[model samples]
Target chain A: MSFRGAVVTFPGSNCDRDMAVALEAVSGVPAIRVWHGDAELPADLDFIALPGGFSYGDYLRSGAMAARSPVMQSVIEAARRGVPVLGVCNGFQVLTEAGLLPGALMRNASQHFICRNVKLKVENSQSLFTAGYSAGQILSIPVAHHDGNYFADDATLDRLEGEGRVAFRYAETVNGSARDIAGVLNEAGNVLGMMPHPERAIEDALGSSDGRALFESAIRSLVEA
Target chain B: MKVRIHVSLKPGVLDPQGRAIHHALEGLGFEGVNDVRAGREIELDVDDSVSDEALDAMCKQLLANMVIENYRIERVAA
Candidate 1:
């Protein structure tokens, strides 16, 4: 059976196409496009991606409106059923707002939008999303956002770290995130949310193939399971 | 009925936008500005029959994110 994936698109989503293309290239299957208003996903989807961009123009808060959209309700149910969900950049903010992940993505402490490639250390190699990366391996991924700084209480941070739920950590401080967290996995290890754009780094044309392994690993896990 | 909701970040939560505005005021030579914190105000028009419990539910569910912010609701006679 071929790998099946879907990419959700919101009004201001710019990276949905890139995420679909990346999934298609890596999984050898066409990705279904789902709009934010749709109440359900395509049947039997192996992966669902919430790509980057200013959904709802970042109004009220980053991802606040999008998180409450019609489609996210279905996505939340699907994620609970064990389907893999990957949220990138603004999508990360959505997941947090939707309560799929703990904490909030607040504005950078510097109060300036940051756009650059930053180094990330793979912190958990056991998650479905990070199995292809070795623990402690540093890779460069592009991060561009005004509200990417991660914040949670100390106890929540400690719990996430102790439970091996932190998937990636910034090798250097880029956005003033608490504890330099770049990415995290849900308790079930199926849902992953990260600020960096791995989809943007998946090919040599982008000057990096560091992100290809992430897609490849998801596809591999789907096929093997 | 008219209701006013004031949503403010929790005291311990960092307010980056508010901090930036404070710095801008300082740059403009505004002296002795003790502190600055930013919050939001929302007004709602509702039926006179709407109950207090229902309005509180609205604030708890959507008008405020309790994790980092608190909200005050005021009801005004229409």
Candidate 2:
């Protein structure tokens, strides 16, 4: 079966094309482009991606406006139905605002916009997005954001850790994310949100091919399942 | 009616902007400044018929992120 993936684009979303290119490169199928104003998603989507960018010009809050967009309503419903969803950087903020995931992304502790390749250790390799990586493996992915600091209460943090929902952790202190959490999975493990841009690292020419495994993992599982 | 929605980070949440402001204030030779936390005040004009329940709902649903922020709604009489 052919892989079916869709990339959602909100106004001010600059990385939507990159995300689409990465998905097509790996899945051998062009990803459908969905607009934030649309209330319905394309049918039979096996995977959905929310790419990084300052949605709504970071007004009110990063990803706050985009999270409430019409398309997100369908995206949230799709995620609840077990369709694999991947949120990268600003997309991660949207997930939290939309209540599809836990925690919030705040201003970086350094108070500066970060744009560089950082190391991330794969913490959970059993999920649909990380199945290609081995547990404890470190991958270099590019991150670019000002408000990528992840925050959650202690009990919620402990619960997420206990439930094996921490999918990736920063190998180094790149951001002030609580407990160095770089990525997380929803309770069901079908939804993954991360600060780094995996789509930007899908090729060696892009400085690293480490991110290819993420897309391949989703495609591999959908093909077999 | 005029409504002011004050949105603030929940206690214990790190406030980097507030910290930056504190540093700037210290640079200006100010003393006895213990701490600084930043918040937003949004003003809205709505009909008097808009009930308190709806105002609270608006704050909870969109004006505030329950995970890390708290919002208080205040109505100012015209």
Candidate 3:
């Protein structure tokens, strides 16, 4: 069976094409490009992607406006229905804003718009989006954002740690994220949000293909299930 | 009804923007600045029928992210 996915494009989204291309490369099928204004998602989608980039001009806050937009409501519902969702960078912000994920992405402690490739440790390879990697494996990925500092209450952080919901953690401190967390999964493990752009690093020509494993993992989970 | 919402990062969350501003102020020879924190203020002219619960809901749902920020609403006129 062919894999089905959709990459939502918001008004300021710039990485939607990259995400779509990466999804197609992994699934061997063209992924649907969705619009933020659309209230309904393409039905029966195995995967949904919230790609990186400034949405709503980063107004009020990054990903804040787009999180409340019409399309995200449907995306949130689909996630609740067991469809896997991936949110990178601004998409991560949207998920948190939509209450689909815990914690928040605050301004970087350095107060700079950081843009660079960083190493992330595969903390939990059991989730749908990360099963392709081994536990504690360090993978180089790209991160670019002004507000990637992850903030959560100590109790929530402890809970996430105890439940093994922390999907990826930074090998070194790239931002002031709590416990160096880079990616996280919901309690159900169906939604994954990360500060790094896996789509940006999926192509070997682009420098790092470690990110390819995430897309492949999602596809594999859908196909085998 | 006129209302103002003030949003600020929860205590213990580092505010680098505020720190930088504090440094800049010190560079200009201003003293006695014990601390600095950054926040935003949003003013709204809502209908008279809008209740306190509705205003609080808006803050919790959209105006503020409770995880890292807090919001206070003050109604000037109704």
Candidate 4:
């Protein structure tokens, strides 16, 4: 069966096309485009992606408004049902705001919008998202955002680490995230949220093909299941 | 009713914007300032029919992020 990936687009979502293209390039199936205002998601979706962008113009807070949008209700339900969901950058922020994940993305420590490629180490290669990479493998991916500082209480941080839920960590100090976490998986291991734009790094021509493996990993998991 | 919601970063949570404001204050030679933390104030003009519980729920659900910030709701005479 062809991969049924859906890319959700909010009013200010800028990377929806990139996410769709990445999914299509790897899965050989066009990703269904979902609007933020819609109350329902495409049925039987194999994957759902919340691409990076300043949804609702980052009003009130980044991803805060978008998280409460009509469609996120369905997305949240879909995620809870064990459907694979990947939220990148602002999408990551939304996932946190929606309570699908723990922690919050705050302003960068430098108080500047950082845009560049940073090195990330695969912390857990067992989840559906990171299975394509080996543990401790360092991959360079691009990140661009003003609020990517990940913050969680000490107890919560410990729990996330203890549970092998920290999927990726920054190899270098790119943001002021606690323990330099770049990506994380929910307790169920099906939902993944990350700050780096893996969708932008699907090919070597774009500086690195490291992100292709992320999409490949999701596809491979479905095929094996 | 005039309701105001004050949202401030919880203590111990780093506030980069507040720090930046502090640096600017120091650069301007403002003295005796121990520290600076930033917060937001949102005023809502709601009908008297809106209950306190509804206002608190609004603060919790949308006006303030409960993770890194705390919000206090104040009702003032219009």
Candidate 5:
């Protein structure tokens, strides 16, 4: 069976198409386009991606309005059912606001929107999102966001670390995130939320192929399972 | 009833916007301003029939993100 994927596009989502193309190129299957207003998702989806962009104009707080939108209900439900969910940049903020992931993405400590390729350490390669990378491997991914500072209580941080749920960490801190946490996994290890834009780095023409590993790893896990 | 919700970042949480504002204030020659922590105030004009529990739920669930912020509700007499 061919891999099936979906990319959710919020009103101000700018990178939805990039996410779609990346998934299609890597998984060899067309990704369904899901709108934020839709009440449901396509059936039997193997993966769901929340692309980067300023959803709802970053009003009130980044991802706050989009997280409460109609489509996120189904996305959250689908993620709970063991379907792989990858949230990038603003999508990471949405998942946290929707309670699918922990912590919050506050404004960058520099108080500026940072856009650049940064090195990340593969903290955990056991999850479906990072299996293509080995533990301790370094990869460069593009990060562009104003509200990407990760914040959580120290106890929760300790728990996330102790449980091996930290999927990636910035090799050099860029956004003043607590403990340099670049990405994380949900309790079930099926949902992944990260600030970096891996979709933008999938092709060498885009300057890096490190991101292809993420999509490839996920597809491999889906096919093998 | 008119409901006012105050949403403020939790203590010890970094507030970059607040810091920026503070810096701007200092640049303007303001002195002795120890710190500035910014917060949001939301005003909701709801019916008197809305129960306190429901209002509290609204603050806890949506109006405020409890991860790094705290919310307090103030109700005006109907």
Candidate 6:
């Protein structure tokens, strides 16, 4: 069966096309574009992606308004049913605001909008998203965001680390994310959220092929499973 | 009935925007400004019969992200 994926687009989403292109290029399966107002997703979706962009113009709080959008209810349901979901950058913020993941993305400690290629170490390579990478292997992915600093309480942070739910860690102090967490996996390992733009790094022409493995890993897992 | 909700980042939570404002004040030679933190105020106009439960639900569900912020509701005389 071909890997089927859907990419959600909100009004202010700028990276939806990039995510679709990346997914199509890697999986050889064109991703269905769904709007935020759509009540339901296309059936039989193997994966769902929430691409990075300033959803709802980052009103109220980043991702705060988008999290309560109509389509997120369906996305939440699909996630609970074990469909793999990847949320990147603003998408990561949406996930945290939606309570699909722990912690909140706060303003950077440096009070500056950071945009650059940052080194990240794959911490848990067993998840569907990171399975293509070797454990502790470092990859350069581009991160661009103002509110990328991840914050959570001590106990929650400890639990996430103890359960091996941390999927990626910043090799350097890119942001003041607690414990240098760059990406995380849900308890079931089916939902992954990160602040970097993996979709932007998928092509060699984009100056990096590091993110190709992530898409390949998802497609490979879907086919194998 | 009128309700005013004050939502604020909890103490110790890093507030970069607030800190930036503080720095600007210090740069202007303002003294005795011990601290500064930013917050939001939400005013709600609801039916008099709306129960406290509904207001609490509104805050918990949307107005305040309980993860890093705290919210306090005040009843304002109309």
Residues B1-78, model 5: lDDT tens digits? 899999999999999999999999999999999999999999999998998899899988888999999999899876
- The top-ranked prediction according to lDDT is 4
Please give, for residues A1-225, the per-residue lDDT of candidate 2 as tens digits.
578999999999999999999999998999999999998999999999998998999898889999999999999999999999999998999999999999999999999999999999999999999999999999999999999999999999999999999999999988799999999999999999999999999989999999999999999999999
Candidate 1 lDDT over B1-78, as tens digits, reads 899999998888889888888999999999999778999999999998888899889887677776678899999777
lDDT scores of the candidates, listed in order? 0.91, 0.95, 0.93, 0.96, 0.94, 0.93
By lDDT, the candidates rank as: 4, 2, 5, 6, 3, 1
lDDT of 3 by residue, A44-138 (tens): 89999998999999898888999999999899999999999999999999999989999999889888888999999999999989999999999
Model 1 spans with C-alpha error above 4 angstroms: none
Ranking by DockQ: 4, 2, 6, 5, 3, 1
For model 6 chain A, where is the 10-residue window of minimal lDDT?
A203-212
| Candidate achieving the largest DockQ | 4
Cα deviation of A151 in candidate 2 (Å)? 0.3
Pairs with backbone N, CA or C atoms under 3 Å apart (clashes), candidate 6: none
The estimated TM-scores of all candidates read: 0.97, 0.99, 0.98, 0.99, 0.97, 0.98
Candidates in order: C-alpha RMSD to true structure: 1.2, 0.7, 1.1, 0.6, 1.1, 1.0
Could you give candidate 1's per-residue lDDT for residues A134-212 as a string of tens digits?
A: 9999998898999998998889999999999999999997888999998988999999999999999998899788998
Docking class of 1: medium
Stretches > 4 Å off in candidate 5: none
Name the docking class for model 4.
Answer: high
- Return whichever of 5 and 6 wins on DockQ: 6
Interface RMSD of 6: 0.8
